[model samples]
Target chain A: MTTALLRIPAVRLATHLRRLGAAALVVASVLTAPDPARASREQTGDDDGCARDGADLPLAGAHFAPRRVEGGVAWDARFVVASDAASSFRGGALRFAAPLPAGEELVAAPGLGAIVEDGRIAGLCVGAGARSGRTVLASFFQPLSGDGASALGAPIAAGRAVQIVDTSVGDARLELVGAPLFEKHVGFVAPRAVSPGAREEARRLAGVREDVSASPIYLRGEDARGGLTVRVVDARARAETSAIAVGVAFAGVVGGLVLAARRLRRAASVERADALLASEIDAAAKEPAG
Target chain B: MTTFVTILDIACGRPIPAEDSGRARRLQLVVFALLASLAFAGAWGLAAGSQAAGLAIANLYKVPMVILLSCVFAAPAGLLAWRLSGAPVRGTDLALGFSGGVFGGTLVLAVLAPLVALYYQSSAWAGPLLGIGSAALALVVGTVMFVRGTIRRLPPGAPKLAALLPVVVTLGMQLLTLLQLAAIAAPIFPERTPFSGGIDHLAR
Candidate 1:
């Protein structure tokens, strides 16, 4: 009878459950199930904190190339998120010191979305299936206030935060690299075009690494608030030249005005004399057929 | 050097000497004044175009060429007006006065050149605006000087306005021509404006 009962499907399932107690079943199920959120954190080993491990693993790296636009300067920016086979970036945020100019949009690359709120870019996300190692995450153009060569030294500040899976890290400073070429009103040229001496001095002031031949200069530095800032030493020379030109121009204007005034005065005297002589001649001619 | 000084004196409204009153002497004075005008205009262009080396080189010729072309285009109209008006003023005398006006105008540009360059490097809006302002100021001053120089050469019996007929026609033609020329010579300023490209740019 027992054998016959065991042949029934429901009775067999009950017998199996009885053999493996409910407690044992629950424990096995819990141990076998996957926890994707925790697994991601464990694989990346970023459990401690994002900002604390910034030195060991930078959240992202940024590169900027400044070019002269119609009204101001446009900084062509590229961002590369830190990633490895076991872990990948999920999203990030960027806040500028000053609000971006009105009507300007932050254009992000495919597989990423940039959301601009007020002056900050928030809720930036990396799409699924993105490459893990040294992948370019996003790129956009940022407008700055300046014209011509003067735009070269304009101040720049941006706060970076990166998200890895469920763990979001704020205050993750980025490594900034300036492009090898700089834009002049005439066209694009290397920093050496500004004079070899100036280029050397600019590189020294910016503390660019000597080994990096591809990027000779890094215009950005960390500020008091932990945001990236731009430093341009070559702009000082430009300012000095501008001052001298203005001084010379002012003196020229003054001298020219004085000279013009003297000439006008002399001309007035000549005109008066000529008018007197002409009137006398006319009077003589009209006087009784003289 | 002496000839240059004499030309300068005449441009400043001094009476022409009897020996210098001949058509040949008047033509010489006009040529000298024109050369001087070019030099002054070139100086201003250097300062204004200092923003870029290529632009600086171009302006060296561009600024003076604008003045030269304006004069060239306007001279024939002035001569025609002189014949029609039946004025006692000689055409050569008119030419001399016009040349003097050109010199004066260019002198102003040269004087303001440094300031323009300084501003161009330092300020965004002010630089271009100052450039346009300086050019306009030079034009007004030149117009006044032209009228004064021409009137001084007129005979006592000649109607002043009638004698100035050629001057009026030349000035009008120059004004019209400069407007178009400014368009052709676009980018006198670092920033492009509606006026830079002239009527076509504005229409678009």
Candidate 2:
């Protein structure tokens, strides 16, 4: 009797549940992939977090690269270096070919722009890009160290920041610098909310709108290490030099596509339901309202 | 309320014309613009005499709801424009427009965000801009509608685009962002330097 009950038609929903369960697993893995490895760094007391003083030479194990960008600039050198805490700063390096003027340099980088007497780099300038024939960009996130974080303290699992120099023909626009451009620090990050579609799930997703403007903000030592992020600047694809007007117009196009998806999904569901109801109606009609 | 819901229902059923669709968006944009202009005037007012930041904050909070309502039209207008209007939407046009919109939107925010900070400090008599906000709001809405409207009426093959056009466009933006492609050119420029020291220690 127990085996017969298990084989009953009612158990068919079990197959669907299993399918859904597998889908959930796939989504979970995709969204929550392993976090980036935090290179361990020794943390000192409040004042002497890293270096006793500072050093200017390229770190022995530090990773650096030079690539050509789409803008007018000839080329750019990129760096991602890890260092010991001897210097208060984790590590430092900049593009010699294109540097910001001294005055602007102090004001440009949010946490790592100020120059020192010795010239050894302090404060990590997250992302760097050039405009007007000069590359200027920066993002300051936390360090892998225990006590030694970026300008912003402990990693803010999802924290993001951006710095940009707008040099459009008429006026300027904010460009994403060190911080991740689309995340919360910019006031319009997503993924703070992404749930499986509800039973009546609309096909399209919605996003909170935010202004992408750059302001020089004041951050303290306790603020960095925002979520480990990798901001990849790809020029090989020539994606950046793409026209500006095209980007703006696409926002409208994006909105339209979202609506279409919702309607199509809804229509498909409706059609299935309609077919089932029609078959039921034919039987009911034959029975004559009894 | 029922009437409003019905209006929303109609708006949802078919894509509204750009002129018609932007009605809500333009309202919100103008309100935001007006609020910005008001904040600007209020700052000038506070400096001169009246304290208007508090009132400004209160109004600022209301701005989102207005924006939410206005945003209802975004997807619809985009659909209708793509489906009904006969226009050519090249890859470049779509990209430039969205980027420009975001850029303009940011400036609009910067202009008004100051009022929020000010209102935190001042109590009553928050920023006042009965006249400026109204006018600014009108001008901004009108301008945005005009700009967006032109796009909707792209030369010809717009409406004929496969239903996939809109989805592809929308998904492309999010995908671009996820791939961290939005700021593709960020790695180079004015060049990068390793670090800058603290202000206090350096000055000393």
- Considering every candidate listed, which one attains the maximal TM-score? 1
**Across the candidates, what are chain A's individual TM-scores?**
0.33, 0.17
Worst lDDT run of 10 residues, candidate 2 chain B, spans B188-197
Model 1's CAPRI class is incorrect
Local accuracy of candidate 2 as per-residue lDDT tens digits, A1-290 = 98888787667888888999999998887677663211122121122212333344232111111122222121111222223422333433321221221211122332233322233222332222211111223322222222111121111111122111111111121223355323343422223222223101211111111223322121111122232223223233234354233334444444544454455444434554566577678878899563
B41-120: candidate 2 lDDT, tens digit per residue: 33322331223444344333222222222333243454454455433554333332332332243334445545534553
For residue B63, model 2's alpha carbon misses the true position, in angstroms, by: 1.5
Displacement of the residue A13 alpha carbon in candidate 1, Å: 45
Q: Which candidate is the best by DockQ?
A: 1
DockQ of prediction 1: 0.04
Interface RMSD (Å), each candidate?
13.2, 15.6
